[model samples]
Target: MNTVLVTGASAGFGEAICRKLIADGYKVIGAARREDKLKSLATELGDNFLPLQFDVTQKDAVDNILATLPIGFQQIDILINNAGLALGIEPAYEADYTDWETMVQTNIIGMMHLTRTILPGMVERNFGYIINLGSIAGTYPYRGGNVYGATKAFVKQFSANLRTDLFGKKIRVTNVEPGLCGGTEFSNVRFHGDNAKANDVYKNVQYITAEDIANTISWLVNTPPHMNVNSIEIMPIAQAPAGLNVSKEM
Candidate 1:
């Protein structure tokens, strides 16, 4: 059985991915900061799921915990870099500097650090899959998306560059970008706990769900070893990138 390590597994897409992968018969190590939530998931998932508690934003903690994986779960054949977030939805100049900093630390720095730590093992074994959770915001920008979108764009390009560098060998790198997903803490975090405001973002719209993303991942990993999917972008029928904005003089 192959071992899979997923970050941001406490909730949202990360949580759903863990359940799906386990159901598909793979041992999963779910890493997130919320120990209580991870414990609950472990209870429900039984022995197949290993709950790892640590904030991905902290490189030291991430490195230390992963460095000491137990015997049966040590070799991670698939790594899902799903730990990321978006803060306040204010425009670039009006956005809080601290919020920008937090986004950079978690989305860019943390993901790279964790990947750096794990890539060597995958290379040595001559087999691995690295899937990054990017966003449509990266490909198409919108008001208030600012830094959050920028970080995802970075992810998109980074995945491409990684594939370029890993030209040969069995290792594969893919960037999964989704648009207008709901049923997660995404908007709630961006709105800073404003349930009403967050709810409004998805009200009456058939947005994507965490399960949808998990399904995509399951399919991606199940594909034949000879084929590698470079990138995939998904969006709900109700959502599509609009044309560029225009302004008129008063």
Candidate 2:
């Protein structure tokens, strides 16, 4: 079985992906900041799952942890960059600077760092797959989705550029962009722990579940080596881009 490395394995799409991959007989290195959650997952998954605890936002810690991968887990055939978050729902002018910074650091910088670290090995072996969790927010903008959307847009473009750079190589890069996904810590984190408000985001709506994304990743992994899925954007049927707003009496 090939070994796969997934970031943000503690919750949301990351957790679901881990479960699906392990079930399909793949050895997974699940990395997350929450050691306890990762430990629980490892316990449930048995020998196939190895838990590495570290915040992706911490560059030094990322390097140290990955550099010391044990002998059995050293070879990473696939990398799933699922460790991103949206901080706030306020417009740019009213948003916290720190929140914006956190999103950029984790969504863009951390993903790039981990990808860079893992690429050399893949290049040497001449085989690899890179899967990034982007968002439909990247393509469709909302009132308060400024920095978060921008970061995801970067993810989408970066994935495309990576494929171009790897032309002729067996390596594959895909950006999975999802919209209106629920059953994760996303809204809670964005709303800063306001559960009621967070809950409202999905109330009475049929939102996409983490399991849905997990299934998508599984399909990508099983796809033929010769085929490359450049980018996939998913959204709940109930959701669609809003029309342009105009001031009637300004």
Candidate 3:
């Protein structure tokens, strides 16, 4: 079985993807900051799923996690960079700099650290797949998205450049951009533990589930070795383009 490494594997798309990949016969290294959640996933998924605990924002923690990988598990055929979140919904002018700093650190710097650390091995092997979790906000700016959108925009461009740089090397780089996804911890995290506020965000809109995104990822991973999916953007029908909106005065 091929080996895959997935960050943010405690819940949401990360957990779902790990489950799907394990079912598809991949040995999965599930990394997350939540030890209990990771342990539970490992238990449920059995031996194929290995739980690793670390904060993606911590460079030392990330490096230490990599160092502790089991010998045979060292060969990572696929890397899923999925550990990221938005901290606040405030506009750029009103948003706290702390939130912006957190978003940049986790979404951009953390991703770069892991990618740079693991990419050399892939390059040497002449085979690899990198799947980044981007957002529709990356392409279409929305009110209150502010720095979150900028960070995902960075992801979009970085993924593109990575694909270009790895040309002719049989390495694949893909960006999966999702819009209006619910049934996950995303909004909850965004609202900073305000469950009621998070719930309200999706109450009026049809949303995609974590399983939907996970299935898409599984399909991409199962494609023919010669085929590379560069980018994919998915949204529920209820989620029209960011441009299509009816505003109401409060």
Candidate 4:
């Protein structure tokens, strides 16, 4: 069975991807910071699902998790870097430096550390897939998304560079960018636990769901080996590019 490792497996696109991959017959290693959520997913998905608990921000913990994969789960055919978040929606001038730091650490540093750890093995194997979760904010910037957008832009560039570097190695790197996704903890976390505020962010707009992103990842992974889907940008119908006003009076 092909084994895939997914970070941020507790909820949102991560959880949905884990479920979809399991259903598609891949041995899945679901990694998340929340132990309870991981356990719940393992129970729900049965034997093929392995729940690993670790904070991606913790470099030592990430190293340990990658180093100690059980013999049966040793082969990692796919690595999905999905553990990332936007802490606060504040313009650069008014944004808290702490929030900026958190975004940088998780979205950029953590991702780099994990990719560095796993990529050598993939190179050695000469066949593996790496999917990085990015955002439309990376391509189109907006108010209150200063540092968050910058971080995702880093993801976009990094994924592209990886694909270029691995051109002849049969290692595929894909960047999946999604826009206006609801039904995830993203807005809630961005609002610092203000559920009402989070709800208001998407109140009028029809947003994409976690399952939608998960399905896209599944499709990318299932594509023929020779076909490498380099990048995909997904947006909800109700949303458009940055600075585009969709709610203007008719």
Candidate 5:
């Protein structure tokens, strides 16, 4: 069985992906800042799951934790960069600048740091796979999606560039972008714990679930090594890009 390291494994798509991968006979290192959550998940998953607690937003923490992985889990065949977030949905003019900093640090800097750390080993062994979780917002600009969308755009281009840099190597890189996903704390976090507002984002709407993402990842990992999936964009059937707003003065 291959070993995979997944960041943000405590919740949302990360948690779902861990469960799916473990069920498919892969050893998983579930890394997240919440030790309690990761520990509880490990207990349920048994020996194949390793709870790795550390904040991905901190470069030193990621460097230390990944550099000294335990004996059995030292060799990571796949890296799943699932840790990211969106802050307030307020428009750029009224939005908090702090939120933008957090998004850039976690969504861009932290991800790049961790990827750089793991990539060398993959190159040395000539085998690896990297899957980044991007968002449809990257390509479609919407109100209040300013910084969040920009970071994801970086992720998309970063994944593409990694493939270019690794040309002729066995490593594979993919960017998975989803639209209007629910069943997670994403909206709640964006709303700063306002459950009512978060809940309202999905009410009466058929949105994508965490499990759906996990399933897609599983399919990617199981695909033939000779094939490479550059990027995949998925949206709930009920969700689509909005048309340009028109201001009319009659």
Candidate 6:
């Protein structure tokens, strides 16, 4: 049985991935900071889903959980680094420094720590796949996406570097970059719980959904071992580059 471990599993892409994978017959461990939500998911998903509650920012917590994983959930063959957030859309000069720091701690530090802890096992077993959730913000920069974009850019590069390090091994690493996705808490959290502002961003827009991402992940894992997909950058047809920025009277 293929066992997978997903971070940020309480909601959004992580929740969707867990739900989809379980339906496809993969055993899954869903880790998140929200204990209540995780437990609720456990109740809903039954024995195949193991809800792990711990803050990814806490290295010790990650270490503890991995050390105590139950029988079916212990050997994780796939790792999805999906527990990331964008705090605000403010420009760097006017953005919250605290928000930037939090983004780094979660998007970069937390993710890196978890991957490092899981990799050795994969190496020993000679089988593993890591799919990181990146954003198009990382490649196409918007004015206010400074730190969040940079963090995802890091994910892009890091996943490539990991594949380089694991060359000649059966392990695989892929970075899944998504653009303009809605139907989740991403915008709500990014806007700091301002539903109106969040709603406005997706008003009548046909953007990607959490299920779309989960389905992509499902395809990645099922691909043949001889093949490796380095990265996939996806944006809805309704979204595209805004072209050059200009100031006629600045």
lDDT of 2 by residue, 196-244 (tens): 9999999999999999999999999999999999999889998988889
Worst 10 residues of 2 by lDDT: 241-250
Error of 1 at 34 (Å): 0.3
Worst 10 residues of 6 by lDDT: 65-74
lDDT of the structure predicted as candidate 2: 0.95
- Local distance difference test values of all predictions, in order: 0.94, 0.95, 0.93, 0.93, 0.95, 0.94
In order, what is each prediction's RMSD in angstroms?
0.8, 0.8, 2.1, 2.9, 1.1, 0.9
Error of 6 at 54 (Å): 0.6
Model 4, 1-250: lDDT tens digits are: 8899999999999999999999999999999999999999998999999999999999997887778888889888899999999998877888899999999999999999989988998999899999999999899988899999999999999999999899899889999999999999999999999999999989988899999999999999999989988899999999886456676687
Model 6: residue 73 alpha-carbon error in angstroms: 1.5
Per-residue accuracy of model 1 over 88-139 as CA lDDT, tens digit each: 9998889998999999999999889888888999999999999999999889
TM-score of each prediction: 0.98, 0.98, 0.96, 0.96, 0.98, 0.98
In candidate 2, which residue ranges exceed 4 Å CA deviation? none
lDDT by residue for model 5 over 95-151, one digit each (tens)? 999999999999999899889989999999999999999999999998899999999
Identify the superior model by TM-score, candidate 2 or candidate 6. Answer: 2
Clashing pairs in 3: none
Across residues 1-250, which tens digit of lDDT does each residue of candidate 6 receive?
Answer: 8999999999999999999999999999999999999999899998999999989999997898799998777898999999999999998899999999999999999999999999999999999999999999889999899999999999999999999999999999999999999999999999999999999999989999999999999999999998999999999999998898889988
- Give the C-alpha lDDT of model 4: 0.93
Per-residue lDDT, model 4, residue 217, is 91
Q: What tens digits encode model 3's per-residue C-alpha lDDT throughout 69-176?
A: 888798989999999999899888899899999999999999999999999999999999999999999999888999999999999999999998998898999999
